[model samples]
Target: MIRAQLELRIPNMTAYETITAAKKSAIPDDAAMLRAAVELTKDISAARAAIYWPDCFLSAALGYGALAGAVLLRETWLAVVCALVAALALYRALLFIHELTHIHRNALPGFRFAWNVAVGIPMLTPSFMYENVHTLHHARTRYGTAEDPEYLPLALMKPWSLPVFVAVAALAPVALLIRSAVLVPLGAVIPPLRRVVWERFSALSINPGFRRRPPEGEFGRMVFWQELGASTWAITLIASTQFIGWRPLLIALAVFSLTAVLNQLRTLVAHLWENDGEAMTVTAQYLDSVNVPPPGWLAPLWAPVGLRYHALHHLLPSLPYHALGEAHRRLSAHLGAGSTYAGAHYGGMMPLLAKIARSTMGRR
Candidate 1:
């Protein structure tokens, strides 16, 4: 029955076809049952692939490239240039990583961890920690409050101040990086910072799976290891640079930072819309996310990561990123007018920014 309920929302080739497909495929000679199983399996597989590899590899490679480029380059400006390129790589990478967390692991053991960590660790963002919070975001009654990490309360915003609001959304990734690298490190050291640390940590532990799921446990351990590894990498870079002189390190850092900033833009594009302040729930995944149907030139970045067809991704998180486009087309063909968005991109920013700014001026 639970499986049957989900089929209604799952993306398929077409609504009529989805229904027909379900009917034709239903289990137990009883078409409904067979269809339900097929749908369920597809859903699970999609989710798994989305979170794990071949799906996630492109993004991870991008992040690694940026950080590595920063470390290896000899010229300062050129190093920064490479770092920017690396950042561009990661910008695309995070998309896959974001999708990967939505997957249910049991579906395809093949693509699971390969994509998750491959894409996740390089971003210096732990897959495990992301999974915990992200899963909660899918829960009943989650958005608009402290629980919604991505939440931005309309109540807090000044009415009509579109520019400020837009600015907030645009610069959010910067805020995230600063908070992660600076605030988190400081929070760890300062006794007074315990509250913030606990709040973030509590979010991880508060979830039911945090205590019950072994995958969750593994994630926790991985977070510790990744953090240690990232720190060690930073330190090693520093030491090596001192020995060889700072040129290489400086170049690498520039490339890495550039990539990080580009990632911020793409990340913001994923969710910066204005909506009623409803709780972000599992069922609401579609609402909180956006799809990026990339142009041919951008496909190299988005196709591998599975972000180009993100709406389908929200519907099926475990499917490998590579499979997302095909799945999305199939589902989109099935759903037709039922879909809400085709998703937007950062390139649409100039007008969006201007509109928001105008909205704010009128309010003031």
Candidate 2:
């Protein structure tokens, strides 16, 4: 029978049953809880999400302005200060890409275009790369499996791979520059090259095994223009370096590299990363993900723009980024001490990193 075949295909029915029972007991009605949270936050305006645009623009301006001031002043101490500030600001601004994915197109008209022009193109990480790709990671059947483009089992990898994973992000700026400046143009002219580029270079994914399918319809047109914009920006930056001098370019690279590194660090603790390509249950995904709650002063610095409630986001993917905090507060108050949600809270980054390190070493 088809039911028997499905049971055979599922790796561990015992484990699945255990997880299902746990989830049911912990949150008696997950759907109702989510619906209530949605209703509770319904009166909150979607326009609050649009307000992120000005903040992101201002942050980017401050970052670049400080870097320029540092270059003009020609002081090592000032340059160091400027670089740190730039890194923080740029990292925060770049995170709007995540927000852009969730915000309805009609709710924030022209905001996506503004963001692409200001942050996405200049950084060579256009929004198109992430738009369609991230949604897959949130898919119920895809998450924590090989099909999830955004996930990898870091805790199950070799102990040495952890440091390498985080350190490699420092080189992302160079890789992104090459991707935009060299790959995009070449791919445009050659059909075969375009297919290769689409599969390999198009997505903002971390999984090595994931390959992107070619964009189609309106998505294809959007991808084309976004790529063109990034290519033009990359070419301009390269050409301008010759006349404007390389110092500013070097500062830009440094800022980008630092931002990438900071993001990688945040990502490292985003989850326990122990799924090992298994098709996880919803509770398993929530348990594997992390949430760093209050009293952690540095949580916002690392997990900015509502990422601090990452596990909760997975549970309620439709909730806008601006409403996550309030949702978490409501969910916590409603769910109380016995809820499975408590298991997702890591308290702070240091503890999370330590737990991951222990898990990595223990697997060794």
Candidate 3:
């Protein structure tokens, strides 16, 4: 009913190129479009520190500022307003974690540290949560398979799973607190628990069956420091309630919970989520992912940090967040609307979300 009302409101919206479970076999990749995507975007692939630093820092700064106002204002309507602002700003800041997984570590020196200090550890989502995990989603053989940490066949699951998938994220702040403040700290004392936490709870992933291998090499060393920072922060946050009282902590948790929910909603439509755990070709994976591109508006707000061009991101995983818009424009104009590259471009977030929701209900 909400979707029907939304569709009626957008009477002039572009008709979407919907892909459902039944439509999988018919949607093949255009090899020429693939080559064009790689070739055309080469010049823009390098991450610009100029764009990365300010965006992440400002978003984090604004988020925390608003969160403070919310807590200070108490239960008033203005506090509610501030809380919402905090959620949105922090959601934008938090999504930089996705960019962290893709961009070269050396490109933005101190960015990883700054982001962790400002946004990541405080939010209990250090860059390490995504660093090793998200790359597998782009692996040629792992994309859309059980091995893909981020892949989930939501369209193939029962209709109930859709709401469950999204609703569960509302508890993410609480879950992260427990994971960091309790499980991780305990895991440090118990070797078996540490391995379990590493295998099961370490990643920011959607696939229930996906278990991450132990972190190795310099990556492992990086993980240790990040984990220590996150755990320490989490412990401090929990312990603060005794002195500062529950009001501030509860309000902050509520704000973070809202942020998590927004992200989960974005994740819901990030892809069609219809691969059925099979290995897919690169183009097939790209087609499965969704892009909520421009002229519709509001995508950048919901799918911030260049995530609005998610399908294109899968095609050229190294293209930095700031460059995605230009890359998308070049490819869209070059390939035209009828090409496979255009297959993933949708009108807007609601329609794309409605499309995915409908898919789970056994409709096209």
Candidate 4:
């Protein structure tokens, strides 16, 4: 009966499929199921200013405080512990950039500027980098293709590619440093370099072929201030090596490097990565995304800020992170374990990582 019902209903393609030729997945269509996701989440759609403010601020505060502790503490064991705490907290704070993209412009006024001041510029990953770009990943037609900046056909790649994917992320802190300090400063004087930098280096993306359009209007103005802020901070950081010495700066980079790796690991399992550069149905995109809900306590630590429910977020992009847990509960109960909605649920990070790695090996 359930199988029969799923076949009768289906919807449009995902952000990966929003642009070009989007074909329905071979899996049975679940139009009613998709509708249920929207209907169930209606009550929780509003973003709460209270939650948004504290979560981002507190996390960034704890991260920076711990980072300072790590740099100052002389004992090896204690400093190592502080460094780990700093990395995890900062990683949580950094992931808020994802939220900034989907959130309404006026939902949390001054949030963009405050966040850039607190975490974004310091990390060299301001909201402007992701604000306009990430929406394409959720576009009705662009997902899973060369155009989807966040989508990569990783499951179909060679086994070696998986390790390389992670290794590249470890260098993110250093790469971002150069981008802010050197490239951006030079781009200010040279129009062509500015265009190339905007198109190529400005986004937080996974697909190499995904080029960003130049920011214009209000967004372009936002980019200018953010670029200036990041450059100034980056120069300050570089100058600090002369006054305070390289030890402190290097230590800070080390903490951020670990934070970057943790984020990459979380991102790896956020989806099934089985799209193969083709358009996917909305349900296919949801299924391609993985949900690590309950009984997985470790998920919150790593995939913090409702990111543990990534697949669900794809269903309701506007839903605030705080409400996702209750939303997941309601949807799971409404749909049941055997339903198409439950197909995206997974246990933990390692298993999901193993699954993706195995798929790369042709075992899937």
| Candidate topping TM-score | 4
Residue 58 accuracy (lDDT) in model 4: 98
lDDT of 1 by residue, 1-364 (tens): 6346435444332221133322221211223322332364464353443344443465556567666766776777876666666666665665544554654556557453555456544334545546666655545465334555554533224655333433444343334444455555675579567455434542322222232223336676765565554444444544675689976545544444454544444443444333345443332344345555544455444233655454455455455565666655554454343432222222343433343344334434
- The deviation in Å at residue 162 for candidate 3 is 0.4
Return the candidate ranking by TM-score, descending. 4, 3, 2, 1
Which wins on TM-score, candidate 1 or candidate 4? Answer: 4
**Candidate 2's TM-score:** 0.89
Model 4 weakest 10-residue run by lDDT: 10-19
Q: What is the model-wide C-alpha lDDT for candidate 3?
A: 0.84
User: RMSD in angstroms, all models?
Assistant: 9.1, 5.3, 6.0, 4.4
Off by over 4 Å in 4: 1-24
Model 1: lDDT to the true structure: 0.47
Candidate 3 on 133-206: residue-level lDDT in tens?
A: 99888888888877888888888778889889999999999999999999999999999999999998989998
Off by over 4 Å in 2: 1-39, 45-50
Per-residue CA lDDT of candidate 2, range 1-364, in tens?
Answer: 4334433423233222223323221322244444555666666536564457677899889877876765676778988898888888888889989888877888777889989988898899999988999999988779878999999888777788889988999999988888889888998788898888889878888998999988899989998899999998888888998898988887789888989988998998888787767676676677678888887899999998889989887877766777788787877787664455565777788888887888778767
- Where model 1 places Cα greater than 4 Å from the true spot, the runs are 1-81, 93-96, 106-123, 153-219, 280-288, 294-304, 337-364
Residue 188 alpha-carbon offset, candidate 4, angstroms: 1.1
Best by lDDT: 4
lDDT digits (tens) for residues 39-144 of candidate 4: 9888889999899899899999999999999999999999999999999999999998999999889899998889999999999998888988899999867778
